[model samples]
Target: MQGHGYGQPVKQPPHTAWLVLLRVLFVAIGLFSIGFLAWAMMLRLAAVTRRSLDWGLFIAVLAADILSIALLSMEPGDEIRTTSGNFAMFLLLGTLVATIAYYLAADIRHFMQREQAYAAQRTAQAAYAYRGPASPHTPPPMPHTPVPRTPPATPPPQRPAPTHIEQVRAELDELSDYLRKHDGRHDSHESGR
Candidate 1:
């Protein structure tokens, strides 16, 4: 018996402490920062909505990015002489690496899980459902009551066609009437204002 039997405590692989730490970091920093960054952008664009906490995270991330860029731009000959500067550089770089790694792993895992779910659904459907080609048989018969033939459509009663000049005059009259009504109202409204 190489494997543990039923009801017996199975010998599972030991949990990796680093994996747990990575998950915590991923949720705490990766998700939190990304969400806040997006929210802050929306708030900035809208101009009316403001949440200070989200904006704080956005600013912090932006500062970190700027600092990292500066650190990377420095030549190998140049170095941070201060202890705090060195620590900040190391912390920024390490966090960037960890965030990238966690995001990539999480994304790949999500994709794989979705793919597996879709595959399983397809397999289950294929196994249980019979989806052969549609029957070659003719369509079903209509009701026993014979369908009545439709009568030919009659043309609508036609009005006497007006001349082009008359049409234009009619339109002009409508426009003049509209202007007459609105112009007085506009004058009264402006006077009131």
Candidate 2:
């Protein structure tokens, strides 16, 4: 049987593995830039730890990209070609990291919203059930009386609609009965045969 998917596992984005690989590279670049290359790492450490690591990583990535860009711009022709590979890698990793992060955040937000809605609905149903009926004098609504069901009166045992096959069978039976009435075959047909 044919399926709509390309054999990927359920509920995963198409390029998730590639995104994961890029994230690894992105992390390496971020660590390298902040650890030994940039002087602002210490200054940003407290803020980044307190707030969001994403902003710190983003700043590190930016500094790395700028450094790579500047180094590549100073290189000669063939050297530039060789060194540009690192810059390209960083650029591609950055884009993938940002894209995956955005999508992940959106997915988390939607999941939280869906969970909250479900929780609200459950609470509302619980409250309604606890409150019972609006009027205490009124009896609880009896679950709809069951329509006095009596096997639907057996619907008079209706004969089914005749399909083409059934009609053909009946016609064949009628023909056999007619042949039997006429001494098995028409005289003219037997003579011709």
Candidate 3:
């Protein structure tokens, strides 16, 4: 009646306190549902890499939602309506919010687990590079055994001597050295002239 227009029917506005209380209750229930789902999933995930599709909080939420709807359907002025399901729609909305949050949490968990597995595999591959390839110049790791300093009875097999490329490189190097020496001499003679 406070906000009623001259020709308009009286409209009842919900009390500020009741509205605030109902909103808070809805948010609290929704948050509780989400948190419960996340905690249960995390525990289950710890048991195995495969996620559990079954949610423990799901039954609780469904029960609460059903209870709220039943209470809301009661006639106004009935003791049931006043005592229970007073904020039926709000509680129902809360359940929806909780469900949405639960699914998001599951998706995030799956994505994060996949990323962790990929990173671990990549790290295992990189570990080979971290130690790096053995160089021919460096000696191989010696065995832990401590042998006497006696020389070998027979010499080890000799490696084949440097071949064609080595011969060509040596020849080219000698020719280059000769040309450099002559060029210096020619330069000095020209300077003198």
Candidate 4:
């Protein structure tokens, strides 16, 4: 095996001709599908828009498809094997080609216009988004810093200020203690006597 660019052997298809044929077959299918889709789309557009020219073209193409199919399927000595039949086939095919071309062109134009509109809309939006300063006179406001949400440090609970009545009660209790001490000393003196 011959080494490729990266020191790897080039892998080849088992049947290159068969693969090529398959690709051609798929391409043909895709093209036919696209052609049919265009035909359908033109018919719908003609109906919705009520355009006489589009309707005529749509009918012509439909007739072309039917006639072509019939002609190709018939045996050589059939009734449609005459000069008139050949002329009809040619006219139908030409009409089909012209109709396909017209619709394709119209579709392309529609898409291009849509793309341009979208681009213009995007540009307008971008212009709005990147607006200049409202006024070149004043400075811009400072960016706000978010305060951290830590729990507040609670202060120790404080005693309320003493009331007048409570202060008087405290003084009276001190005086009673002093009088008790002095009266005990006097009682001791009397016992000695």
Candidate 5:
């Protein structure tokens, strides 16, 4: 017999790396905007100084970055009409967008760090409040209750003697033997007839 051989390899569609990269970029942009908003809110709540200025700068930088990206994406491009001016414009726009993105990212990182610190402080304060003796509102321990004991049982009362009719029934049973002897012959004659 011929030697056994391995099965043929299954083929798969080609990888769309460029499309995947573009999708990832769009997702990053959306997340960055959300994170920026959250950071701004946290800073305001924590009563940080100059929070308004910080937020204003952040918004301006983000707007500029988005506008530059939009303009660059809308620029005309064809297979045969590429020019040096167009390339330079694209590079400049990309650089400005990247710089603004980096500035916003740095600010967001700083705000997150401060928020985490505030959260930790609040947690520590709660722990202290629970353990402190200044408050007399602590719950009291549960009381233990004793089970009740049952009383001992008493014996039933003695019954009274039987009535006169019950005594007559006992006397009749005692005379049953004499009556049986006297009626034996009569009973046998009646049976024969």
Candidate 6:
């Protein structure tokens, strides 16, 4: 009666196969993107007579693609026969969107960090400027000193002392007497019934 009617623990559907397929697809797409980007870089470099292919960006994109693919591929079940296929598709699509969003977010974060650093640098420069040279300079004439004022004294307020053990015991006894009287009345009424 404590167990389920099925007599066995329900098994979670396998999704491993679907994850593998999604990962493969993601990697394929990523490789394609990299190739395209490289080609684009080459064209740009050729046109300007300078290396414009940002290796850093290429590496970053590749790393992101790899990590995304890995995460998607680790999911469990056969993509062709199970619900995993649909899940794989959804995850792939989501990964693509997330990748783009992450890229934009990363760019924005980088820009903000750079801007903050620049502002901090400028602030430091301003502070240093205000400090001026360390060499000794002519000091200004001393101003007249004002007399110090004395503070008014006030008497301290008195506080009651803490209750001693005897006082506490007396209070506890009073409470006990009150409770016993109430209990006695309750018992007498119950017995009469």
lDDT of 2 by residue, 1-193 (tens): 2323322222323254654564455445445553233223322332323445545554654565566556656666645365465665566456445534543454344344444455544543444344343332453333222222234445654678753333544666677778777974577678887
Task: Please give the RMSD of candidate 4 to the true structure.
Answer: 31.4
TM-score of 4: 0.38
lDDT of 6 by residue, 1-193 (tens): 1322222232332254653464355445534664222223222223322323334444544454455456546656434444554454455455455454444344334344444455544543444344332222332233333322333266544865532322444565677789999999999999999
User: Residue 50 lDDT in model 5?
Assistant: 54
**Candidate 1 off by > 4 Å:** 1-63, 67-77, 131-193
lDDT of each: 0.48, 0.47, 0.50, 0.53, 0.45, 0.44
> Which one wins by lDDT: 4 or 6?
4
What residue pairs are clashing in model 3?
none
Output the worst ten-in-a-row residue range by lDDT, candidate 5: 139-148
| Top model number, TM-score | 4
Candidate 2: give the clashing pairs: none
* Sort order, lDDT high to low: 4, 3, 1, 2, 5, 6
Q: How does each model score on TM-score?
A: 0.30, 0.27, 0.33, 0.38, 0.27, 0.28
Off by over 4 Å in 3: 1-54, 73-83, 125-132, 135-193
Summed backbone clashes in each candidate are: 0, 0, 0, 0, 0, 9
- The best-first sequence of candidates by TM-score reads 4, 3, 1, 6, 2, 5
- lDDT for each residue of candidate 3 in 1-193, tens digit (9 for 90 to 100): 1322223222333454764464455445456764333233333333333434434454565576667667677847545446455466566666566555654456445544454455444443343234323333443333243333456688866986653334544566677789999999999999998
Please, what's the RMSD in Å of model 3?
A: 26.0
Model 2 misplaced stretches (Cα beyond 4 Å): 1-51, 77-79, 84-130, 133-193
lDDT for 178 (candidate 5): 69
